[model samples]
Target: MEPARLGSHLVVHLNRLKENFEALKKRYKENNILFMVKADGYGHGIIEIVKYAFNDLGVREFGVATLGEAITLRRHLSSLPFEIYVFSDLQFFQPELSELYLEYRLIPVISHNDDLDVVLNNPKFSNLPLCLKFNTGMNRLGLSLEKSEEIIKSLKAVNRCKIFHLMSHLANASMPMSTNKRNIGQKEKFKELKEQFISAGIELERTSLANSGALEQESCKEETHIRPGLMLFGATSMAPQHVDKSWWQGKIISELKTKVLNVFDVSKGDPLGYGSTPCPQAGTVAIIALGYGDGISTRFMGATLYHKGVAGKVCARVCMDMTYVLFPKGTDIKRGENFWIWDGDSKMFMELARETKTLPYELVIQLTTRVPRIYQID
Candidate 1:
């Protein structure tokens, strides 16, 4: 069946995801891969990414930022042999959440000592498998070194629920310069915990400590499992200082395209709409129906968009639902022609990030529900 048309009309390239996973798998063949699909797979559509990652890439484990996200993913995937881990540490929803976890066979990350307490006492987690998250230096979630060792001892005395993997998150993996310090520190911390797990008789069968940034860092590959999020989406913050063009070898997995709504010529003296912003030199102006509300940054007002091999500068103030661009003199532009806002062929997103002073992660998330996303197969 042909997929239904999207209301907002954005396209997600599935082939790029498959290629990225293939590349990563080739690079780290020894490690188990847990595809991180949190934040809607970093705003790339979780279900679609999951399908490609699992069906095409052979990924059997997934990571989510919240219990809600895990539940949603489970509902969409019926009986796939996948391990769904919730990265969040919240335990308040234990009752309802535990029921769902049991129902869907989801793996919950136990962060604090209180987490085990809540689970052991909760009726739903009586016999379910739980993944313990150890916080080496993040100081965010997971049990501390001292606390974790103590909990490991306590679990030996009780009906130790099934344990999936011993895991920790890397804070400095993305910054290649900090790899020595941050990676070393985390390795030492996890090493201590690994010993404790052995002493406590927990096999620590499946272990993971790497995110996207750690994939490139040799020190992070120490763990048997690697959880990658950004790299699988073909977006990387691993930009070198000199900006090597070869670094962008991976294909862009997401592209935002919009059609020109109207085109007209404006004189140099004429002030453009809103804020009475100064108009460009006498030239053709094209209005596009994509704006901040649709994820285009307001700082992109002066940013450039390429259409039919010609570049146009976004002019005037960008409204909530629309923006205007001025094409060079005599440059023919027609209505209904597609405009490339951000695509594989251009550095529009990189420019937008610089102009808005925002990270690529933020820029993508801002693309709210107003813009529809269509998943395209390779």
Candidate 2:
């Protein structure tokens, strides 16, 4: 933020990221946390977020979506002690990718028989550490719970890696689990599978099912580990407790800011850009450099951008490379003044999302690489 950074840019605050992470750790002290680094660390730059999480936060495990992401992280972070799990990927089951999985020390989640078969048939991967994902109630990529006995029996014979995590996805984690039958059933079934494993004389090393939203609810209790994606980056799907909410009080990790490109006067009768939309009121008109092409769509036309302690409405249609803002009449402004856009704070972010009929997840991920990211580590 020093020297008034010009143009539209995302300021990545590593310090806030640390605070957000520590807050999760403080409350969930008993359960291990696997930082979800998929989708390029939820569009915050994978390498940057991973390195910080590993070195500064002492995070030992990460979860990615593809074989490429797992191998790529292993290459860049050769010295770090970490575990990368491929949740769902066609590449994960390919015979060609089997060696890369062993070489990179990546753990593959066996969602079905083929995923487990690929590992069981190959001597190289037969002994590799793996996670078993069960369908429970998600109906996504997971084996049926009844296959728990057969799957564990197959793995118990050849696996030497100490990792044995029974994993599943909660279809209704965004809602309260105590009130949702599907979520409760998923948790109960997963627990039954764990007991089934113990009955077979193999104590599973861990069990995981919690995501960002699940951590705030009662479902987080039984799990030995939690997978946090969005919350670690400064936004949560659920309302957080006061202790955790305090960290997101005044600031955010990813600060979206843009400089005012132009300032003009628009009378009530004057026509505006594109479509010649007549001005709604006589106000101070300011143009910014961010637009639809930058991932901010037309849905944000009415959202507000804060500048110099005042909020200006995005009055005109968002163009490919520019947007028009309308401030109150006689508002003081300049072409180079910085305007605060989205800050990745759940409160403000969700507010904008409500106005735009978008999700906070959608907005953050939509920001293209065109909006350069400036790292702040202090």
Candidate 3:
């Protein structure tokens, strides 16, 4: 079925996503790549991204934040043999949920001790595969290094449950220096815990510690697996100083576009928008069918929007469904012409992120579902 077109839409380039994945693959040739597809593939539409990554690129592992996301993906790709890791702690682990995980063959990342106990003690999940996360530095989730011995002992006692992987997160891998102290420290801690378990005769099949930022560092390059989310979607994980933009070669995957709804000739000192900010001089104002309601940040005021190789500044405060763009006198722009809010230009997107005081990831994910998503392989 053909989807209805909207005034404002996000065009996703699946080819660019594949290019980004290939770039990462070249850099981490020996490691398992667990593409992170949480937050609906960072708001790029998870189902399509998964199909392209799995069927076309041979990505066999995925990481999502919640059980619901995993379940949705599982239902969509029921026939494919792939592993989905749930990153959230098991606060809601129950007999029924355990059975579902077993039936679906989902791997749960046990972060807290209590959650580990529940999973190990649950009879339904006795033979289920599990991943143990350690709190090396992120301190957000995962068991502490001090509890490594206890966790090892617990896992050793488990008769049916099997340990699939050991994982930790690097907190500051995106810092300026490649050899960040915190990143190094976290890697060391994780290594120590891994060794302790191995020496105790517990076979940890795989270990993952690198995120998108850590993938660039030599310290994190040797992990058995690397879980990348933003980079896979063609967005940078850190500031430019920390990550070389040239190395990424990641094209912007989403293009945000809208049409000029109307054009108005404003006189000097004329009040504009909700704030009634007066225009400094006579100029042409182009009203676009997009605003904060569509995830266009109010901070985007004074930013540039491009049309036919010409750029104009947002003149007034953004409204819920409309925004005003100011152009020079005698400009040839007409009503109903397409204007690019974000044109899949890397430099422009970076500037937008800077103007909004947020990361590229935040900007893309903030795109509300009100705007339709159109997928294009080319």
Candidate 4:
């Protein structure tokens, strides 16, 4: 393992990423899987992940959030035949950039009526597929069901409009499909649109609504394609005790490690940094070299830093440049010894997410570029 170019950095376990992908494949069972490579592969170097998926994992399709991500991907692997779907890019509708779409084989997932109009009104875009997106219940991207009906009515005249794919998103799939009202409603709405497509004689090449969390819901299995994002980067976000039959707790592939910058004894009544909270007991307090500047926040006060598998309680509120951890007096930790701000343990990561009151997605993408990512292949 090469040393990280920085004092604190992420060790991205590419092999574990492969494991997670395999797990998702087994769960999905032969369905077309579209890896969500957007947000810089969820802040895990995008190009490396894409190449590994294409050349090593045999994945042929990916979904990104912008033309810039797709364009940058195309520039690197120009000759590869893998597909890149831009989920929310208005740039693809621009006539000036339209050529790049064909050149790069970029498929734009259109959600708005006007964007769809841009494609329908132009002859150049006629040859491209209609990768339509509808806002079933996410209320995010995609058109409303009523608006979608209006557009599907208009598409009847455009014979060249290949209804290649239909896509939507779920707002709260973390709950059970049987009890989650929003999930049930969204699935029904999406199915209604699919039925409409069939009735209108519009053939869809694929359909997707399942993101990382939704993969657990059986309702999503009916769709032809699955778009998993956070899980691919090794974040299941499921609590250990709550994991059930449908749990897709993939292997964590990223580990955030930071070195101990300083170590000193603190009296039982002595105050720790940035807070009036006294040290619980006389112990050795270590100052970790990483903090909020590296994406860790004061909210992680509840996180326990682990060095050599020994847990140390957070002694004070996290600072921008450092965090204080109180270890037992005789603990074998020392300055320069790396502590797992978070290692590749999914449970530890979940605990930190719980402490920070953030989604696992936020934790990964929040990492600043200043914290270098070091790939761990084996």
Candidate 5:
């Protein structure tokens, strides 16, 4: 392996990503993979994944969360013919966003009636492709089924705005057997909305609503296109206990390792980090470069680290840019030695989530964008 990069260098396993894409294609052969490249491909480096999927893996469409994200991706793949769509609500960025949609040939997911006007009224965008987003029940984004119908009628009157796709989001497809009525209601409403759109003469080039949750459910795969996020990174879908099996199936996509900046010997009674947390027995302590500022949450305080196949527990509260771990007496550790924080053999992220009482998605996204992403073929 190469020298460990400081801060966070998410090591994406391109091989595993390819395999996951294949599995999804096999499972939903009729649907297209709108591989979610949002949040910089969920902090795994969007540019690398986009290129791999389009050039080698046969994926033709990508989804982003913001207009800026879409713009950044377009810069990277200037000549790729793949279609790019922004999955976020269209209301936030009006004329400017609408203009970008027209210029880049990008599709904006419209969730509100006013959103349609932004595109239709903009002289520069009156003739671009648009994706109508129906809210079925997620309620986070997308227009209600009734409002969506009206928007369709309005769009039909104009010979401009080309309709590319009709889309919706799933609220609880991850819990395939959930007895939650909300999930049931959302599914029914989304299905009905799709049928209504077709009956209203609002023909979409493609109809899609399956997200990661929907892809996990047999019923959700009926859609013609599905957008998958965490699943592509091999994270467990809503169920933490099911993680071990997922790990084996997908290679560790993000490997966060930091270099040891210093090493010191401390007495058993010596006070450690903020608030004077006690040092672990009398032993040598090694400090690693990474902390909350770099996106390593404070919950990582008591998390474990792997050095040369041996496990060591963090001995103090994590600082804004560093953390210390106690090594057993006379253990071999050096200033430049690498420490694995969250990688193939370590469950630091899972452990940290347990300490903070949170989920993997929160932990994953909390990792800031400042951290450098290093991509490699394995």
Candidate 6:
């Protein structure tokens, strides 16, 4: 059955995604790419992105935030021999989860000593590949450096959960100059912990310290694997100072387009949208079928969008399912005309993000399932 059609939709360009992956692969020639598909491929649709990456691009490893996501991917790609690493903590005590982990062959990243204990106690996880995350500086997840030796000793004693990878997250790989010291310190700390594990006679197969930002830093390239999330999807969270923008080959993979639902002429001092924010002067307002409900944030109240070749300023508060944009007087806008909110243009989205005082990740990932994803593979 056809789903209820919404005028608003996100167009994901598969070719662009492939290009971004190739660019990163070429740039980080030494490291294996663990393409991050968490957050629904950063809101690009996970299953689709994973299929393209695995079937077309030959990406053998994937990184997800949850075990559920890994299970879903495993089911979808049952025929493919790919490894999925769940970055989130695994509920090791749950027998059901242990069964699922064994049945699907999902790798869990042991973050803390408690999690390690769970894995060690469960003989079902024996001989299964595992990843150990150290909290070098992120402090979000992973074991602390102070407890690294203790954890390693415990793991060596149990001899369960084969250590496939040793990894850490960089707190500031984007701003190379500003966070240079912190980045170096975190790397050193991770290295120290990794060496400690090695010296304890625990053989670690691979190490991944570089994320998308760290992958670009010359100093942060010493790793066996790199997990690139935003950059693989044709966007970057890195600051400009750290990268030569001109040399960036990644293209925006998602294009958000909607049609003008209504066109109305307003008088001077008239108000629009939820708050009735007064229109500065008499002008034409084009109401598009897109709003906060569709992941367009309220912060985009005064954002600008282009239709045809003319630009229009978003006026007033954005409604749940509609947004009002004001254009100049006598503007020729039709109800069915395409309103380009974000059209696979990185600069435009960056400008919008700046105007809204939000990050690109927030804007993209918050796009609810209400907006259908249309793929442009060619």
Per-residue alpha-carbon lDDT of candidate 1 for residues 1-378, written as tens digits (9 for 90 to 100): 333242235678898878877788777878888888888888878887887777878889999988788888988987677889887844445465556667777787878777777776665666766678888887887787777756766676575733668888877665662435866788788888888778767777778888876675433566889988876777665544423322334566888877788899888967888889878688899998788788776787777777777888888889888898998877778887777677764256666666667766666667877777788886
As for lDDT, the candidate ahead, 3 or 5, is 3
For candidate 5, what is the TM-score?
0.86
Instruction: Give lDDT tens digits, candidate 3, residues 50-117.
Output: 88888999999998898888889999989889899889934354656756677778888888888788
Write down the lDDT of every candidate, Cα atoms only. Answer: 0.74, 0.78, 0.81, 0.81, 0.72, 0.81
lDDT of 6 at 195: 79
Per-residue lDDT over 196-293 for candidate 5, one digit per residue giving the tens place of the 0 to 100 score: 76777766677787676556554466677888887677655645543322322433466676788999999987998898998868988988888888
At residue 137, give the lDDT of candidate 4: 84
Tell me the spans in candidate 5 whose CA falls farther than 4 Å from its real position: 1-8, 89-97, 121-126, 159-162, 241-248, 264-269, 280-284, 327-334, 345-349, 356-358, 362-364, 368-370
Q: Comparing 2 and 3 by TM-score, which wins?
A: 3
Candidate 4 overall Cα lDDT vs. reference?
0.81
Clashing pairs in 1: 8-372
Please report the TM-score between candidate 3 and the true structure. Answer: 0.93
Q: Write out the backbone clash pairs for model 2.
A: none
Residue 351, model 5, lDDT: 64
Error (Å) of candidate 5 at residue 297 is 2.2
Better of 2 and 6 by TM-score: 6
Q: List the residue pairs that clash in candidate 3.
A: none
Q: lDDT score, residue 311, model 3?
A: 76
**Deviating ranges (above 4 Å) for candidate 2:** 1-5, 156-163, 239-251
Candidate 6 clashing pairs, residues 3+ apart or interchain: none
Which predicted model would earn the best lDDT?
4
Clash count for each candidate, listed in order shown: 1, 0, 0, 0, 0, 0
lDDT of 2 by residue, 1-378 (tens): 454355688888999889888887777888999889898887778888899888889999999998888888889889888889888884754578778877888888878788778877777765677677889888889988777777767766775334478788888777666666887788888888778877777767988998877775535666889998887887656533322422332235788888789999889868888887777889999998888888889998888776775788888888998889899987888988777787655577767867888766677778888887777887
Arranged by lDDT, best first: 4, 3, 6, 2, 1, 5
